[model samples]
Target: MRWKHPVLGEFSNETLIHMAEQNGLIFEVGHFVLHQALKAANDWLAVCPTFCIAINVSSVQLKNSGFVEQIRDLLALYRFPAHQLELEITESGLIVDEPTASDILNRLHILGVTLSLDDFGTGYASFQYLKKFPFDGIKIDKSFMEQIEHSESDQEIVRSMLHVAKKLNLNVVVEGIESTQQEQFILEQGCDVGQGFLYGKPMPSEVFTLKLESHAQA
Candidate 1:
């Protein structure tokens, strides 16, 4: 999500998120992003109905008092299947409001939308989160993948993550697989899904649809 800045020339998604936080409206912005994801998901599913969409949920969005209702309303508005949607929430975000988070997460789970812990290894008390929250998958942070090929320690770290996800009956997605070697290594270690420039750079919905269509045809 890079954007041309009047002064900075360009800003990345992280910078945008950071800027949003400064304004203290990140929660509101997150809600808008979620709805946009739903719209895109609805678009893709219309063409390739088997497609499953994953959207990140910021902690602020999760902690909002009316989040659950907003989600319910959006799901109804989009007519998107709950089973086809997966929400990825960060570990740091969940600690802000445990009881509320738990209740809302449970409700989302009951709604049949899959949940995942994104950037799994970068936050506090990660292992405990797997036990406390109900998630169907764990997204291995790109930092681990960046070193998985060159660093023996990283290989071991990824292996351990896979083992934990396996034991918990959760799926594993390794992001940032920019090379064939990276893809092979993660697959060999039992990772079930992956995403990176090795596949394609991120693009607008129309471009993504074209790529997906070609992939489907292939």
Candidate 2:
């Protein structure tokens, strides 16, 4: 949050953090949000059938000594189904320390919560990390989507990524698709899921709830 009340108003998390005088509260807030993830998943899935939620855990969080137990406790406390939750961890987060990463990743897998390797292509030791960890899926970096249609090389890259996913049996969710053409092309490339402005821009929870209610009614 901003140190001083914004004269213009800060309406988003990014802006709130940007206006902050220091990074002191970010981790605190993030720590809180980790719990909120459980609450949201428990509350939402209670009312809606066949739904899942994804939460990103930072590298710092992953390496925390109690991270897996914290999740285990949260699941027990909230009675949240581990299968209904997916924790997306970045490549850098996992590769920083192998033994620690290996231990926690295994614990997470044993807990039955799905793991996704976030930002698939932009980090170090991508292939090696994938092989070492039991990740359930991959989130293709948006950089490739920057020119998916215009660049044959981009399309080829996308295809190659899809091929890797297939061989590894890891689902692919391509990001940054912003047009009908891009969406169609990504589907043709065998991406399992797509996210970008073409689907919907990020919005406040109130707006999302209204849309969700509308869909439920429909």
Residue-wise C-alpha lDDT for candidate 1, range 54-157, written one tens digit per residue: 87777677777788788888889898988888888887679888888888898999988899999988876889989998888899999988877789999998
Which regions of candidate 2 fall more than 4 Å away from where they truly are? 1-27
Worst 10 residues of 1 by lDDT: 11-20
Reference-based TM-score, model 2: 0.87
- Top candidate when judged by lDDT against the true structure: 1
What does candidate 2's lDDT look like per residue over 115-141, in tens digits? 989888887677778889889999998
Global CA lDDT computed for model 1? 0.84
lDDT for position 199 in model 1: 82
Cα-based TM-score, every candidate = 0.92, 0.87
Residue 18 in candidate 1, Cα distance off native in Å: 2.7
Instruction: Please give me the total number of clashing residue pairs in predicted model 1.
Output: 0
- For each candidate in the order shown, give its overall lDDT on alpha carbons: 0.84, 0.77
